[model samples]
Target chain A: MNETSRAVGWKPRGWDVLNIVLLSLLALATMYPFYYIFIYSISVPEEALKGVYLIPRGFSLQNYVHIFKQDNILWAFFISVARTVVGTVLTLLCCTAFSYGISKRNVPFRKLMYGAVIVTMYISPGLIPWYITMKSYGLQNNFLLYILPGLMVAFYIVLIKTYIEELPAALEESAMVDGASYYQMLFRIVLPLSIPVLATVAIFNAVNQWNSWVDNLYLASDLKLQTLQMLLYTYVNQQTAALSMINSNSTAQTAFVMTPTSVQMTITMIATLPILFVYPFLQRFFLKGLMLGAVKG
Target chain B: MEKTAPRKRKIEVPLLVLTVPFFLIVVLFSYVPLWGWSIAFVDYVPGRSILESAFAGFKYFHRLFDSTSDFGTVLRNTLVLSFLHLICSPLPVLLAIMITNLRSGRFAKFIQTVTSFPNFISWIIVYSVFFSFFSIDDGMLNKLLYGTLHWIKEPSNLLSDPRWTWWFMTLATVWKTVGWTAIIYIAAIAGIDQEQYQAAEVDGASRFKQAIHITIPGIMPTFTILLLLNIGNMLNVGFDQYYVFGNALVQEKIDVIDTYTYRVGLLNMDFSYSTAAGIFKSLVSVILLFTANFVTRRTSGRSIM
Candidate 1:
């Protein structure tokens, strides 16, 4: 009732109008790139070449069709999904286990282990040596390449540990007095209480695994294991590849296809859409974790 | 206090067993990579045993410092880019404040969603967007400048041009990242005490003044935390964005230490030289981190590591 009364009493002032106008302009500018991509993806090829198509010159699905028909896209998509899921799960388990152990009041060698973890977060040993080590371990051209090195995200471990520490000590203490083992209390009490942090870490890891191109560039030499980001990298970064895309789209076999502009935009949309799809389900937990660090810092 | 004597208590069998995998994995993957720093001190043959290779101490480092080396250019590019990003860090804080002050929640959320969306996409995919706006023949920028405004005599492929690489990379990155960064500040503002604002309002303080004196000050700790971390990370201009955006024409202007290492290590197969470069980069960064942490601890009295 108080909030409602305040809202009703708050009248428009000179600054309020200025704020609204400024915000509207910002909203338009912030969204213009996505809008540009959308219209270009659907625009008629001839009209697209002439100039900007604020509205798509023609309502067309040919760009998406061409993108779908491209070779290796399905395989690449499969690799992305498989890596994202496998990587996130493994990373969470590894991170949570360490976080749990370190947070325990009675754990032995806790300070030393925590120091070991924190050191890795700051010191990035050069990539070349890491590559050499992975090759020695037989990770090159391997499907497990995506799953192994990423098993422990040091930063997320710190975050999860912070959350676990804040969890009511009494709750865990009572469980311990009932003769619960460390692992039992972890699986039963700690994890259930830490779902929001877990979800936030999961989303972070999943998006990271999905968007990473570095691993594929250096490690995934075999055609079968290449991720989607690599395909996009090669297509857009190389002028010759882009020229071929244009030429191929103009051919009789692809005569009805949208221009190279449309295909580029469509592929980009496909690459980006997966994260946005999962975002809604995870947003509440993400917001919770965002506040957690701030409130407690 | 619980016994500081950690060695007296017998370690639990199950607890030790369960955590061994995490322990072994970190040492193997994280610490073992550091072991590769030895390659910088010796000639590393890909197929041969690293032990069999002859020692080549300091040669690569000398080469890097030589006049003909691209190291200077790469360092300049990296510093310029990091400086640009550091300068724009305040933009996100301002954006957060603006969003907090907005009259409508729906519009604020909508703006945030749009702003943070680009961060989800990889740099590779972002290059496609860059292509559309800067292509020589039919790019939106070219059309706007040449056809409409008559600003330039000839159409230039702004995306591919060497001169525009620094500004383009920095601005494009800032565009994609500012929203994600701003959310941290927003969370900090939300965590501020409500009584301060109420008290200020009771004293007839304006919203603008309240925001300036209360809201901004409240988020200063968060800002300092981020500032210290950013300074610590100033040396490592990440590889992916430069690797995907760089062309032969703009190689000198856009190449960073990470990408330079990649080209030297993988494509050119100068494994030893690249390892030396990587080791050098890491050493500098570690020094920067300690220095930045010390300064932050003294000033803000807050430290991360």
Candidate 2:
């Protein structure tokens, strides 16, 4: 490549080097805020604010201990875990079934159903009515509150439908001729053939469910049912234990020691870790699925 | 790609039947909730059915449009914030393109991963970082400024000051989301055929000029689609970030339709009035989407639909 570049009268420009340096610096700036929080989370809260540059004076697991001691942390983690798993499964099923049904160009009222999903995606009735409906239905305080509202996203359904549409028709027709039922064809052929896009939808739904917080804020009032992000918000912003510690002649050092910023960061890590763990495996599929939908005419 | 049986091709009733479950979910969660628009007309009460609520037809909506209300302030704030985002959001796309210019693929992806990390952190964490940088005490920014030229006694409370709050919010948004936003544009650039670039280079075109003439035009379709999509969702000034970062002092400047709905419906139990406001928001969003789609159709022969 270097010899070819030289032969072509191409020289690596200084402007390119400058641009690279500037972009790297900007990326660093974007990253430093989270990096700083991770640093603070481990430092005694007092040392955190006092420009604890690069190293923790006294690193401790005390903050994590404090977070766990709150009685609801472990429960919230489980609820979040269960919610992500259950919600993703249910969503995948609903979306896939609907997508499969709709993908058949000859299905009765297919366009109408497709139109219904697309309209809903483009026009949400906003959160107020959705909240009202959930409350009126008495889904609040129920574990189903976390799972039910999340299922059957239109975009995922459409993506899956598009992917199914691309499959060779002969494969499905041959199966149909060989004494296979519709369900049998879908299960044995369509699904296995559509694994890549299915995994793509699964990852997208899982990450969305795991990261969601706004719905729970309005619906789930039970302390035990609180998800990880909600719990983190309550602790970091509203909790008086750390605030009271900060006041009442407590030194800056003491305030720093008490605030569980480290644990909070860890909580963030925990909440997002599942998605991060799954991402590497699904990265190629995700990129493929994304491009397939995004770039198609 | 799939072929069907040629003998009077039949619609699969069983397969169509499978749609019932999904239809039920959509109707229950989506279509049924359209009835909640009536909440705007009534003094909605908890425990009472929506039908039983006291009727106050268009009263809340009137109040929303009333100049006496801070509806104008909020409307103005929403517009300005979104406009600023519209203008400044493209900076990261340029940044991403610059990074992509680096021949080293590993270096580019590393920069991308690092920049995109903040998108995963909750706004609460971002708020904490803001305090560290802008708090009235020994904030890093203030420390640096003071040491360079002893300006003041304390770090300026950028979070509390309304003048600075919008900038703070904008910066926070840019820092967290810009990287993720740029990923699509970067992908768009990557989708460009390299043959054009080679042709331009053979014509003795500089990298910069070639980028302007060939690279940009190649990705213009993606740009048009993204621009249309963004304009359609302009009203969605994400409630999460603003709510987490907002304080009482800056609420006037930062309060959006979503936050206002939360306060009115969830906090005060003015369900009908809040529902009315929400309905108005949805209507506006639908109008925007249609208008944007129409514009795109006319200009580029492409529509989101």
Candidate 3:
């Protein structure tokens, strides 16, 4: 490709340079907000109050120290982790198993069941009905609300099923010949072979579970069930109230020094940190998963 | 084949048993909600069975169209937001083309990676980032404009300003999704036959000409399918972005159907009326989807469904 472009005497033209420059500006624009937040979180409260741009004026871990001291922050972090781990695992298991069943052409009511799942991808019963249904199911204020309703996402089911259908049937046939039960085949043969798609689904589910707070807002009102995202939303929306709550809990010296802006940035960093850490490693899989879904969809 | 057929039959019952739990879950979560649609038709009362509630016929649906209701504002916001989104749909294609045209593969990859990062973060964090930059007081933009640059005399409350709410929401959504959406177009560009590019190059077509004549046309099918899908989702301006960005000051401008439903059903305890609005939205969405599909099938000789 390089040789061909060279053969055409294709040098770095003005348009190419302009494209590169504009894209770099876009990339900077996308990244600068996060950088600004990080700098503000670490800068001295007085300096951050004046406004931070480009870099931190004074380095301090005081904001983080104060964040860690708050019990609700720690509790929300714990709840967020619990939901991501448990929710992703259950979603993978249930969605993959169900997709495996649906992949079988000879299963009774296979078309009906598969059609039902696909239909859901197009239509939703809207928010009010969905809320009413969840409330009736005793999911309000329940941890199961996070795990159960999301267990078998129709999109994930379709992705896994498409992958499973394309797999070599010989392996499953051989396993069945060995008298492997349906459970054993699913756990042993299908699940093992479906790792790529499963990894994709797992990352998608984990990120969603971590990022979601609306369910917490609407269905689960218990303080104990609050996730990190919910806490961030609360802090962002109710800045003065959150600031007072933080100041009221802190020692006088620290409270006097700490500003609401720094605390807010600190909380924002905390909520976003985990995703930042894992994104680079898992992004390729989700991107691949997306392409796979796009093709099948 | 005969031996395997018998074996398959033998385990059929177990397979059916394995599927029952998932089937039940789908029915409970997805199908059961349809029953709640009935609330829109009746005088739904809490703690009473839907069947026992007094039948109100189409009273709520009629009220949805009444000039006095908030539905008019909600519908206007929803359509305006959706239209803004539709107009900006070409951005991802533009981004994809630019990324593909880059001379350095590594820089293109870096651009893609960084731009897509925002998509993974939650809207709450996005709001936090927005607040830090655009909030009225002590926000970075305000501080810079009113303090350092003296670009403006007073701090601008970009987040709460009602006049530009639709456009601002569109910008936020585009910023969050453009990179992610471009991936599919990038994939489509990759799928375009390499021979076509080679042929164009051999014919003395400049790279710019090649992109215009070949690459843009190649990705049209994917673009069309996505546009149709967006049309199908015309009423669903999403619940999250609006919900988080909304303030009492901007409520009139930002209250799309989903947020309106949530406020009326849960906050105001008007479940029946909200259900009526929701049902109307859903019915229109389904009709739009089929209409788009039908139009595509008729015009392009292909159907999205």
Models ranked on DockQ: 3, 1, 2
What is the model-wide C-alpha lDDT for candidate 2?
Answer: 0.74
Writing each residue's lDDT as its tens digit, candidate 2 over A12-31 gives 46667787889878876976
Question: Residue B31, candidate 2: how far off, in angstroms?
Answer: 1.1
lDDT of 1 by residue, A76-188 (tens): 87888899998999899889988888776556677887779777877787878999999999999999889999888777887899989989999988987787888898999
Model 3 root-mean-square deviation: 3.2
Tens digits of lDDT, candidate 1, B162-275: 889888888888877887788778878988999998998776666777778999899988888788788888878798788878888889788899998999899999998898
Candidate topping lDDT = 3
Tens digits of lDDT, candidate 3, B121-181: 9989988998888888878998898989999988898898999888789989998999889
lDDT of every predicted structure (CA atoms): 0.79, 0.74, 0.88
> Fnat of each prediction?
0.58, 0.52, 0.70
Best by TM-score: 3
Clashing pairs in 1: none
Candidate order (lDDT): 3, 1, 2
